[model samples]
Target: MNYETFENRVLPVKNKLFRFAFRLLGSSEEAKDVVQEVMIKVWNGREQMATIENMEAWCMRITKNLSLDRLRSNQRRATDSLTEGFEIRQETLTPHERTEIHENMQRVNEMIAALPEKQRQVIHLRDVEGYSYNEICEILELDMNQVKVNLFRARTTVREKLVKINAYGL
Candidate 1:
């Protein structure tokens, strides 16, 4: 890929890359660094870019790998901020309603963070990033059955926990 093509194709996916990294690393700064590293790797491997059919999925795979590598090297647990990827702001809602929404979002994030790594990645790629099952399978290098199974388990776990929280205030 030439510089212009790189700029057009690769640069546009930076946000998606960063978001995926953040979901894995749980730190914006680390996510930014991962994104920079991904960009450099992509640029250096431009000669082979033509062989890749899905550029966005390719970038996402790079992001996932780099983020996991960073996580393993650091040996630190990843924790998502409540504000990440959540927007409860609404001008029309009363203060009480807004607070309720924020609380619900917080609970959801906590539940997601508590999931196993594979389930977490599958859920984030499918639900938060809006990737289809095929795209998620490609990005995560998993088979379609694995992707669907993880997604189903993640969602089911979250739903069950939410029900318990609401029913018993646990």
Candidate 2:
């Protein structure tokens, strides 16, 4: 793609790209690096994008691959900061309410983080990023049936954990 075309087509999807990267890496800094690497790779390979039907999905796949590569090379999963999360959330509620909400949010986050890698990725792409099943399948390079199954299991797992936490305070 030319400069103008790239600006229009690729640059606009940076937020989606960044969010997907952040979800995968769990660190904003690492996600930013991944997005930059994805952009560079896409730019360099612009010539090969001629027949691609979905550019966003293509870029997402690149982001997923690069993020996974980084994770593998480092031998660690990315971590989100609970304090940082609490700081950025809305403060409209009373202190007590806010604390409760924050605590619950942290619990949910922990539960999601504890999921297996594939389930985690599929859930993030589907729920957090709001992508359709087909898009998720494309981005994660999974078949449609696998994507649906993983997402179903991930949501079910999270729901079960949340119920347990609320019911018994475990």
Candidate 3:
């Protein structure tokens, strides 16, 4: 791709890339670095880009791999804080409602964080990023059945935990 085409197509996905990196690495600074690396890598490999379709998915795959590499090297678990990307409209809700929403979101985030790595990744790419199943499969390098199964298990686990919490007022 030419510079102009790269700027138009690749630059726009930086936020998505950063978000995915953050989801995996659980650190904003590290996520930014990973995104920068991805940009540089993509630019350097521009010749190979012509043959590939779905630039965004390809970028996400790179982000995932780099983030996983960092994680493996660091030997630390991801402490994903979903509120970083989540926004609650302050103007519409009272302070109490806002607090309640924040707490609920935090609870859900904890539930998601407790999931297995693959399940967490599948859930984030599919539900949070709104990627289609095929795109998620491409980004995650999983088959359609594996992606569907992981998503189903993640959602079901979260739902059951929420139900239990509600029923028990826990």
Best by TM-score: 3
Better of 2 and 3 by lDDT: 3
Q: Write the per-residue lDDT of candidate 1 for residues 1-170, one digit (tens) a residue.
A: 78999999999999999988988998999999999999999999999999999989999999999999999999987875758556655789988998888987777888888889999999999888899999999999999999999999999999899789989997
Counting only residues 3 or more apart in sequence or on different chains, how many pairs clash (N, Cα, C under 3 Å) in candidate 3? 0
Q: Rank the candidates by TM-score, best first.
A: 3, 1, 2
Angstrom error of the Cα, residue 67, model 2: value is 0.4
The C-alpha local distance difference test score for the whole of candidate 2 amounts to 0.86
TM-score of each prediction = 0.91, 0.90, 0.93
Residue pairs with clashing backbones, model 2: none
Q: What is the C-alpha lDDT of each candidate?
A: 0.91, 0.86, 0.91
Q: lDDT by residue for model 2 over 1-170, one digit each (tens)?
A: 79889999998889898877776778888888999998899899999989899999999999989989988887887666434534635657788987787777788888888888899999988888888999998899989999999999999999999889879997
What residue runs in model 3 are displaced by over 4 Å at the alpha carbon?
Answer: 80-86
Q: State residue 74's C-alpha deviation in candidate 1, in Å.
A: 0.7
Question: Weakest 10 consecutive residues, lDDT, candidate 2?
Answer: 80-89
Q: Cα RMSDs of all predictions? A: 1.7, 1.9, 1.5
Question: What is the descending lDDT order?
Answer: 3, 1, 2
**Candidate 3 local lDDT, residue 85:** 59
